[model samples]
Target: MTAAVFNHEGPWTEEEYLALGETQQRVELFDGSLHVTPAPTPRHQNISGELRAALRAPVREAGLHVLEAVNVRLRPGRIPIPDLVITGPIDFDELNVEAGDVRLVCEIISPSNASTDKVLKMHYYAAAGIEWYLLVEQDSGTMHLYRRRGGHYTEQSVTRPGDLLVLTEPVKATIRPEDLVP
Candidate 1:
């Protein structure tokens, strides 16, 4: 496995990035640069699992697919791995999915990566034609849902720990925010 590239190794091209070997850590591509992050903690995994569980039946019923921490190539120089992705079942040979293939992209905000998730990724997902984006607050069990409109996204729902989060766009599923915590 390739070691994490910490320092600026100069801007990387798409081909160069794809040719590199995979490591256990998370590495995102943005504007031809590489940003490597550490693996998620157990708390992050728990939240992702809870939501995935809640959505499984609904996703199957609707004939949609859900995956965890997969690479999404939104554009040539933009790639982001969301905590979960809700999209149609697609058959492809590549290691990543195009942003157009995704209906909803979910990110659980890590304390140190809040800005990247809330700002940078939010903008990228919207710009790439992803219709829905879910930003989960890892510590507080809050979900901020954003819907794309006119090249941008606007907040559609702010669900708290006790709220029964009802998603209606790509599919209909009811989730409890509290269940997202361990």
Candidate 2:
């Protein structure tokens, strides 16, 4: 992953922003700038919804909490709202599960976000010590799996719609790219 230049719009404190009490907005803090994510595309939304649905049973049985588009505070004041997040042994009082509690982070690559997803976000997630990262690219109808290795990510596998996504940690579950396609 290449280094991302710090070019941000502005700063946002968690307190001031969380008080807004709004929903369905994807807000992130990149290099101290507030990056507001656009409403997901139809395909992106569908894929995320399906992936969340598929993981529900397994995660619940394992006594894990699954959240959609929740702010994960990667650093002191930097948070990135991942598409789907699975965390373990939670204390509901604090939802801001830092990069450590993150078991798996999934991203349904939007058309415009493909580069950010593959490059910048990939770099951040790896640096943050996320264990597993899954990317579903709609245009090519493929899923790329990555596993963190000593502060970096190694491409585990790239599978098409019909192939199953296998992971070693969190739980034994299968992900089909077709289930994630719009």
Clashes of each: 0, 0
Q: What is the lDDT of residue 135 in candidate 1?
A: 93
* Lowest summed lDDT window (length 10), candidate 2: 1-10
Query: Which ranges in model 2 have alpha carbons more than 4 Å from their true place?
Result: 1-10, 14-24, 93-95
- TM-score of each model, paired residue for residue: 0.94, 0.85
* lDDT of each residue in 75-141, candidate 1, tens digit only: 9988888999998877656689888889999999999899999899999999999999999998878
Give me the displacement of residue 85 in model 2, in angstroms: 0.9
Q: Pick the candidate with the highest TM-score.
A: 1
Q: Alpha carbon lDDT of residue 149, candidate 1?
A: 96
